[model samples]
Target: MDSTEVAKQENIQRMTSNENTAIVIDNENDAKFLMKATEMQLEKISLGKLAQQKGNSAEVKAFGKMMEDEHNASLTEIRTLAQSKSISIPTTVSEDSKDHYDDLNEETDNDFGKSYSKMMVDQHEDAIDLYEDAIEDTEDPKIKAWATKKLATLRTHLERAKQFKDKNDNLNS
Candidate 1:
């Protein structure tokens, strides 16, 4: 590698081992909250799966698939990040997700599509809120920065979901 690449890697290593290592969540409760946040992230991906199965439009289906792909990858990375600090994510799907799945699962394909669209909107909204709060609350510099970036992406997803919902509503009307 060139000197520039070498320097960049060194800088990253420094940051990871330095200021970025300061974790705010120290207590058992904090770990619980962090795990909860991580689970919410996973839930978004889970809901995305339902959306992918139920969506009618190519665009909605594609977006849902994209969310599933991206968040699952993100979940893997986030899991690693958390585990590096000894943070253990919940082993099961969240209770809220269980109820949500129940509520959405029984609908017919057409109704499922609509329900899925709404769920996407709600999930994106919640994701945005969680990340934004994390950006403020997390003492881990690396995690805080990650949350900030993800919050922006989640907001974009929210807008896209809203647009898709509107277009779908228009077509149905």
Candidate 2:
């Protein structure tokens, strides 16, 4: 009747389908993993939209579009996974993310690209760490697989973010 009950039922159903061999992992951990992943993706999507609109460089705008598109797709996949597991994830960005966005939104044109790229670099690093932790900690095969699959993309994003940051740094020097 409650979420935990719902999650337990779903897990039982899934396990029964895979041959009655009990798979005992903490459902709450899976839920928390999904929630955190969702929040991170939402923040990236919001910041990506902002970058596309206000980025001072063509590269920054293009990167923003890529982030928006890729992260949106990732978010959808995450949502589907959460639904299959009966786990609920947050639908909106977190307060920290919103505050960061607001601060970035106030940057001057000359500093916007640099600041945005730097934020992306930092956020992507954090995302990479999150996914790595998930992959290591999640006992559910599906959740682990999802984290593993996304980890590669997150790394690529970090590399791109670093490149953008380097370019911005060079421009200012």
lDDT of each: 0.66, 0.83
* Worst 10 contiguous positions by lDDT, candidate 1: 20-29
How well does model 1 score by local distance difference test? Answer: 0.66
All candidates' TM-scores?
Answer: 0.75, 0.84
The per-residue C-alpha lDDT of model 2 at residue 115 equals 91
- Report the error of model 1 at residue 19, Å: 22
TM-score of 1: 0.75
| Candidate with best TM-score | 2
lDDT of 2 by residue, 70-144 (tens): 999999999899999876667777777889999999986759888998999988898898888888888899999
lDDT of 2 at 118: 93
Error of 1 at 156 (Å): 1.5
What is residue 22's positional error in candidate 2, in angstroms? 11
Poorly placed runs, candidate 1 (over 4 Å): 1-33
